[model samples]
Structure formats: C-alpha cells, structure tokens
Target chain A: DDEVITHAHGAGGGQMTELVDAVAVSQFADAAADVGLAALDDGSVQPIDDDHSVVVTTDSHVVTPLFFRGGDIGRLAVSGTVNDLAMMGATEPLALTSSLIIEAGTPQTTVERVTESMREACEEAGATVTTGDTKVMGSGEMDTLAINTTGVAVVPKGGHVPDAGLSVGDRLIVSGTVGDHGISLLSEREGFDFGGDLESDVQPVNDLVRAAMDAGEVTAMKDPTRGGLATVLNEMASKADVGIDVEERSVPVSGPVSSAGEVLGIEPFDVACEGVVVMGVASEDAADVLDALRDNPKGEDAAIVGEVVDDHTGQVVLDTGFGRRYLSPPEGEQLPRIC
Target chain B: DDEVITHAHGAGGGQMTELVDAVAVSQFADAAADVGLAALDDGSVQPIDDDHSVVVTTDSHVVTPLFFRGGDIGRLAVSGTVNDLAMMGATEPLALTSSLIIEAGTPQTTVERVTESMREACEEAGATVTTGDTKVMGSGEMDTLAINTTGVAVVPKGGHVPDAGLSVGDRLIVSGTVGDHGISLLSEREGFDFGGDLESDVQPVNDLVRAAMDAGEVTAMKDPTRGGLATVLNEMASKADVGIDVEERSVPVSGPVSSAGEVLGIEPFDVACEGVVVMGVASEDAADVLDALRDNPKGEDAAIVGEVVDDHTGQVVLDTGFGRRYLSPPEGEQLPRIC
Candidate 1:
C-alpha cells in the first residue's frame, strides 16, 4: 500500500482509521489487558481489583491557535481526558498525568495561561494533576505545544458502560449541541468575520454525565470529538454490531453552527463537539436520562436523537424527515485540530 | 524574570529546573498523592488501597534519529515508563498508555517498526500497552515523531522506594556502564566517526532493578536519563538531605563512551544512560545488591561508586584519587533528545 499520513489521517476519519489499523493497532492486538488496544473505545479499562476497575484514557491535543474563544489547549487537555473517563462511566476521577512537548521560544505567559486553564479544568472535574513531563523542542520542531493527558478513574467493576453494550432497543441520546467546536476552529483558521456566539464547546462534562448515569443506566457512551457526531455514531454501531437510526431534526445544532456550516459547505452533524456525549440507554429510560441531563448546565440541550436497531448492523442511517439517508464514515479531516 | 524556554530547558539541567519551578512545579505543588509533583522521582505513587498502592509515571521521548543503534522511540517509550515504575520498586507492571504524535508524510514503515519495537519492549517488561492515542501533524510541525508513555504499577504499601530514602551510611551503586545512550546520540548528531562498539544503553533495566530489589531493600533508585548520573544523584542528595561522596575511578564508563565523551567535551557523569540505574542501599547489603545486579545481563558492570555522607548535605563531591571536587547540576542539555 502506498498509504501516507496526512492532515486527514489525524482528522479522526476513515483515513485515520486506515492509518491506525495498518500501522498501530495490530501491533498491540496480542498484548491484551482488561481493555487493551484492540478495544477502540474512548479509553482503556483496567481491573484494579475484583470489585473495581480503573478507566484510563489519553488524548494528545494539537489544536492550532492554542487559545480559542471558549477555551485553550490546557482546558481541552484536561476536559478531553476527563470526558473520556466519564464516557467509560467513571464518576470519580483519581489522577491525571500530563506529557507536554513545548516549542522553545514560546512566551512564558502563554504557558502560564494554559496551565492556569488546565488547573481550573482539573478543579472542575474533581481530579488532580499529580504527575507530568515537560519537554521543550527547538523552535519550529513543533508549532506551539501539544499536550497528552493520561487520566485514571475508578469505577464499579460491573456498573460501568461498555462500548459494545448497545442493544437493539437502546435509545441514543446526545448531551448537547454539536459542531460548535469544529465551526469555531474552522472560522478561526479561515479568519471569518461572521461570528455570532460561535465558541468551542470545550468544557468538562463529567458532572452532567454523572447526573445522567444516576438517572438511568447507560449502555455505552462516546464523546464526539475529531470525527464528529456522525463518525462517533458509526463507531458505536460498528462496535456494538447494531444499527443506529439517527433523526436528523432531533440532533441539536446551534444557530451559529448551522449558519457557519452553510457558509463553509459542511454539515452540522459532521462537525466535532468537544463537550457533547452520545449515549445509549434502555429505551424506557431514555426520557429520564434526557431529563437528568437537561437539569445540568452542561447538558441543557440534551435530546434523544437516535435508536439502535437490528437491521443494518455496523451502520448509521439518518432520518431527514423528508427522506432517509446513510451516514458514511468521514472520508477525511474536514477540520484538523477540532479537538 | 524574563526567562524563556530553551533547548536547555528540556535538557534536564539547571535551565530545566528554572523552567519547571517557574512554570510546571508550582501548579502541581498542592496536588499531592502518595508520590506527587513535589517529589521529582521517576514516577508518581498513588495510594489505591490500604494494602497496595499504584505507581504511575509518564515521560515524553523526543529522541532524534528515531532509529538508533540499540533501540527506537517505541522501545524507549515503553521501557522508559516501565523503568520509572521499577525504580519505585514495582516488580510487576500493570498497564501502559502510549501517546504518539507523528509528522505528516512519515513513512508507514517507520511507524510499523517503532510500534513493533514498542510491542517487544512491552513484552520484555511484562507489561501491556492497553491504551494509546495517535495524532499526526503537518510535515513541518514535528521532526519525525515523539512518544509519551504513561505507566501503571501496583506495589505493596510499604515495599516501595522513595527519592528521599537515602541514609547517611548508604552506598550508591550504578548498574551497568554510564553515558552509552548520551554518547551514542551525541556522536550521531556530531557525525563523529569514532564508532567502535558504540550502542545506546536504551534497553529496559527492570530485571536488574528487580534482582537488586529482591536481594535487599533499596533506599533510593533513579535511572540516569536526561541529565545523567550527576543530576539524578544531586536530586537524591537534595531530597534526602545527605551528602554524596563519589569515587571517580569507580564510576563505570565503557571505553567507547569514554572516548566519545572526550571527543565531544562532555563528562561521563553528566551524560544520560537510558538503561542504567543508580541506587542507594545500606552498606551491609550493597555487596548483595551488586552481586544480584551483576548476575543480570543488563547489570554486568554494576559498581558501587558513592556513599551517602552526613557532612556536606545536599551536595555531591567526587574524589578523583588525589583530590575532591563538587559536581554541580548540569548547566544545560549537552545533547538534545539523547534519550
């Protein structure tokens, strides 16, 4: 294969999958743990004890324009890892380790600002940054900085969500508005002037997720990040071996994101959402989960947007109210560093 | 202070301290776990249960020339983290998380080779790469690749070693030859032709560390990596508040490394050794520990080169047969990415 890594390969799309499958995943297939590399979920789950397990997740944030409207890379680095743990049904996060590769000559003020934001995010998520590593590369060896956070969270052994736990009768609920993060970054990159309350939805969603988990049992959860809502749903479908029937109208999108998508020739559903979580729950408990999520500030716009079906396993179908269509895996990175 | 991050900041030396103290250390000062940010040891120890605690460590490997004579970044990434765990007296490692950032257009072959090496390293260390994250930057955003590995290990509550555990009468023993890793990378960068059996000592030292640990209780342990033996010994002296008296002739340095050091104008004591360990042990048990370490292939050159002294606390003095002198903290990174 003449495959090469590109911006699209980092875009959390099909090409990214190809790169991972061809180069990275198989190497770790044989070294299985409680949740090894073979499991393509948001995080890795390791059994710490017979009755409890530790949910570990790591993400490297390379968002361009380190400082964005709603948040900065520090906040994203913390919330990103925390949210991954939450997606694995961890309500209590333990410790986080940050590995920072910084570009030399970067202003000290920028690093301080980012660290302050990260501190705040960690406080919000009720976790501590206990351990970290920092390396400075010569100027141009890197853009500004890239942070990789590895978080550990403890969960009840049998009471956590699984990526492949979705059932035929499960209802899919989206925590909040999608595409805000993607559009915000895209606009920032293109230097767009049409900005009306378009900010990256980049904040810790553990509190809101906990509320939903308390309201009802969650079969599975995924935070739509680089790949967007469509890609995440497809992943859930494939992992669970079930069909995801998404109602296009029910998928929440803010007015700014909708307008920006139209201007950028992109679909609102295909843009990333940093704080949004797509969760699958029992059909009978979906309403309670939605209600619980809506009560939390972070999940105010929560909605039941889809359902798991028996037909078309490993695929996602969109119901456009006018007509139905198949939602294919993202071809390439529509927006890099969407976070 | 109009301080800025420089290549020296990442060199694990004096400037690195200024940067870490000003930017990184303060942020994590109050976030204390079993072995938190305040202790600049190899890994952070977290108290999970009353009987056993979890040891966690993370390191970012930005070694240049990804493919080296002895090992690649993948192996270094895994072995580095696992070694950190072993330094904390973790005979059994639990899990590892790898975060990789690759430059766009990097050959898939390179990625495969590195990943394969990482898998082998994991196997050798008896740990699993259970979780990982991948990100690709544009062609110029990175210089090939950088890997960050965060590892987890379980240790008996009271059986672990501490950075400040050295006692006044404790002897310092270094496992294997020093400066191999540093000299190799430096020679490669300087294009030195003095290549007589010069290879990086960048293999896992867990077996040697374990052998020594089983032989006797270790007071303190450190892998002489970024800033090499002098920096790590200085850290111990400061932390343990004990003076270190090192015998210059007793410090083991391979012939190739000694030649390379002389040519590069670098001190053997200051050059990093990726696979070597410096340990503080009771004088009575030093011989037993040395015997055990020498039995292992990784520690065949084990030597007791120093001892903790009650005088001149927080300092390291080198006795060069006729006279003694101070070994100050490294001024800067002599060779960058000399992992």
Candidate 2:
C-alpha cells in the first residue's frame, strides 16, 4: 500500500509518489481529447512543429480564503489554464505545468488536498502538469495558497485561429451559465452567505469548447474570467475591430449566483464564468454554435447571448431584459483577481 | 505611454506588461514561446512534432527565514525554471509557469520586490512566465510564501534525453564552484551574524548549457539543486544503472563556502548548487564539455570532477582529498528545501 500525502507530501518522498499515483494517474487515464493528459515530461516538451500560427494570453487567480465553497487551488488551476488555452483558439491543450509558491507553516494536508484537486481538474480537462517546480517561503509572504497554472493548447488544424480570422456582424454565443464561478467565489471569499445549492462554476470547459469547434461554427472563442463577459467582449471587439450587442435576457445565470451578486453589490455580468465559453461565430453558423453548446451538460443553458455588430465597433453594450441598454467595455477591468 | 505591467503586476497585470516590455520583450517576442513574462499564462502552445521522447525532473527552493538574501520569490521563480530547462539540454525553454501560496497579511512591498526580482530572473533566463494564478488564505493558515516553478525543455534532435543517455566510463564535469549558492542562501535565509560577502550564484544556466550543447559533448546534464551535486550523481547512477566515482579534490568549492559548511554541520558536496551544471560526458568529449562550460561566466569554474566506472553500478562514492570516502546520495534527502 502506498502512503497517503501528508506534510511530508511535498517532502519529495514515498508519500508524494502515492499521492500522484492515486489522484493524478487515475484521473487522467483516458482524457476526452488529444490533449497531453498523459505520456509526456514535466509539461509539454514536444518540439515546435508549426509556423505563423500562435496565440498568447494570460490571467491570474486571487481566490480569497485561498479556497472555498466547492473548489480549491488545484481545480482553479486546471480551469484557469484551460480557459487561457481556449482563449487562444488552441484546439486541445496538450499539457499543463504548475508553479507553487506556498506560504510557510501551511499544513501538509492543505497542500495534498490542492494537488489532488488539481489532478481531478486536469483529468476533467484532458491535460496534466507534465513538468513543475516548487519553492517554500517564510510566513507573512503570501496568502494561504496561490497556484500559478499555465497550459499549452495546440490550435486545431482547419479551424481559423484568432489572429488571422474575423469579420463584422459575427454572432456571439456563450455556453451555459454565466457569473456562477465569480458569484461563488465572491460568496465564499467574502462570506456573503448566499443561500441555496450554489457552488462555483469552476469546471474545465475544454470539452465543451471542443464540441463547439467540432460543430464547425466558431470564428473565435474565449472564456470570461477576471474582467468578466464585458471585458472579454471588448477585447474581442478590439482585436477583431468589430462591435458587439448582447440581449442580457438571452444570457443564462443561476438564481443563487444572481441573487448573491445583487446582495454583494456586484453585477452578475461582471462575475467570472468558468465552464462557459463565448464564441464569435459566422452569421450563418450562429444556430449551429448555439445548438452545439446547449448539447453539452455544462452548456445546457447555452444561448445566443449577443451578436457581432459593426455599429458598436470596439465597444460591448448590453441590452437589458427591459429596454434600456448599457455600455459594457471601457468601464475597464471589472472584478480584479476574479480568476 | 504607461509601463507595460500594471494592476496585473500586483494582480499579475498591466504592470506585468511594462516589466516584460522593459526586459523580456526583445528576447521572447515570439507568440508561442513567450506568454508574457507576467507568469500569468501557462507555457505556450507547442505542437508535438515527434514521438518516443520525454524528460522529467523536479527542483525545490527553501530560501530561509522564508525569503531574502539577494533574490526573492519572483526571481527564484525564473532562475529555477530556466535552470531546470538547462539541465534538460534545451537551449530555449518555451515558458516558465509557477504557483504561489502566501501567508496571511504578507506585506505588499515584499510581494512586489519578489515579483520584480522574478521579472529580472525571467528576462535573464530568456524564459517567460506565460501563465499563473494566485490565492489568499485566512490568518494563521500559511507562512510567508512558497513557490513551485515548472519548466518544459524541448529535447534536441537525435540527442539522448537526460535519464536515458548515460553509459559506463563517462567522465563527470561540474560547471562551477559548489556550495556557494547553498551557503549564500543559508547566510541570507538565516540572517546569521557572520556576514562576509556571500553572493547567491542564482543565475540562469541556459546559456552555459547552450555552450555545452554546441560543444557537442556526450550524454546527460542536470542542475544540482535541492540535493546538491552528490545527490544528482547518485540519482544518475541509479537511473542509468551505473557507478560514479567523484574525486573531492577535483570538485571545486569556494574557500568561504567550504568553511561555512564546516561550521554549520553541512557537507559542502551536499549543499545546493545554483547557476551550476553537472554533466556526464563520454571520455572522448570530456575536454570539450569542460572547455565549453569554463568559457562562460557562470561556468568558469568548470572542472573534471570524476568518472562513471563500470563496477559500482547504481552507486556514487566520493573519494575526499583525504583517504576517507563518503557515500553520495547520503542516506536521506539533504537540505529539504534548497531549490
């Protein structure tokens, strides 16, 4: 029998092996896609094979109480990396690598829990921490725990990457519920005490994105994180030099996350939306994109949340469920550290 | 014009941009390789071009008192990542990813210093922190901070990756003086009263590694991190199923570091080595490897430290200048956190 992960889990000994074998080995055994779920070194070490096809993006997580409600550092790590890869229009994230800066005096139990959670998250997303390094710091240097998860997703062939493909009047579709991840984090982070069976929507969205990609409907895709749907919209608009208009009612949000947002004086639209994706689809493919997104379990609540419009070029405006409309971007960086 | 890294600097933000621009921009401007020195994103999307090759390794850092000496969290993040890549025989590392777990109420200033230091480290190593996430925990939940830095290095064409390439009768060479990094970190980490110019040799070893690679030296290279030169030699022997005999007289140790180690009950041979590389070379190419390593600033102290003999398979024994011999890979892990 293998030893369980303990304070000595990070001690580079037998227990660490047990922790990795049990939690990591099993979870990523046969991931859903071709991402580097298994069979690689410390991260993705495969040599570079493509040319002129690349995308880059970055995000940070400052989940409060370090962890809470339903997830911890590891889950957050996988989802965080997967979302970044998706944002790049990378088809399948082949591998992930993590760096941990742990505060001194943290119980080994917490570290093991986080590692196990990361394994689960990676398995769900079809990626793994192939390579990594660790360092320990003294007390009073950081919050309880902060995980830096970075992922490398291979851009799908035949699908247009973000840099080269875009046009005006594209349809904007988002899979599933919005604001849940953020609302949950806010609720747990600040002790807002939102009632009902609500937890962070911090699950990996790679498969859902894959489904959408497979449907042959999207021009570009992104996951709404730290800056929320509004900021992501603006970024796409700026990058593609297009405009966006959204019917707020068409976007889905769970009741608890919504209620929690209102109580915290935060806008549900600005809350983080993990396990969800926003895609720029050709006008002709709009219907297919929505259908594909809604087909998945996590995307069951999908909808045509907005459309790419030339009038609001470089702008993201949301039409209220009522009649009034509100400008979204230019408000700048909503919910810092939401990631 | 604003400085590149901003709120994202603290948040892993716009300030992160300024930092990268001022430093890493010129080095890793490529889309796939550089994710922005922000350490906000994961390593870039690298397409797999070949099969049947993978290299894996882990490193740790335990800068005492939790932080300080010369470098901080951020600096260590890059140095650690780049160094790992170097040991893997890769000249160019795509990106460096990291994680952070900080204690409650850690000073913002200290965090900034470390982050800034990391920026410098990333730039120097020609590596970037493409992706990362952070967290904050409750009071009494963590110490200062701990970091884990993971790297992925491309295995050069037709060259044997580290773990698989060694053979019997190979000569052992070290890039520079041992124990400097260990003692420097010890002095700074503990704030010992006896302070006499102990500089941390925490520089990126990628360039030095490149020098060796160019020299076309024979098989296997590694950074002597947590367990020091002694441990890695033992590990190599064990993994390759060979025997290694290192001559203590040939292994260089700075006078001060040797003296410090004697006073602290530390074995200089077992102390961590930063900015140093230990490589196994075929007897035919030993001189080339040594010359290449010595030509570089970081490896100027390079020397022929020992040889891999056939008999003592899976073991490493050091013959000190005196008649006494000490077993390498001492019974237990030495310096638990000396990344």
Q: Which numbered prediction scores highest in lDDT against the true structure? A: 1
Candidate 1, residues B93-186, lDDT tens digits: the string is: 7778878898998887788889899989988888877777888888898988989889887778877888789999999999989988888877
For candidate 1, the per-residue lDDT at B64 reads 83
**Total clashes in model 1, counting residue pairs 3 or more apart in sequence or in different chains:** 0
**In candidate 1 chain A, what residue range of length 10 has the lowest lDDT sum?**
A28-37
Each model's iRMS: 1.7, 15.8
Q: How many pairs collide in each candidate, listed in order? A: 0, 71
Q: In lDDT terms, how accurate is model 1?
A: 0.84
Report the C-alpha displacement of residue A167, candidate 2, in angstroms: 3.6
Give candidate 1 regions above 4 Å deviation.
A30-32
Best by DockQ: 1
Candidate 2 has an lDDT of: 0.60
Best by TM-score: 1
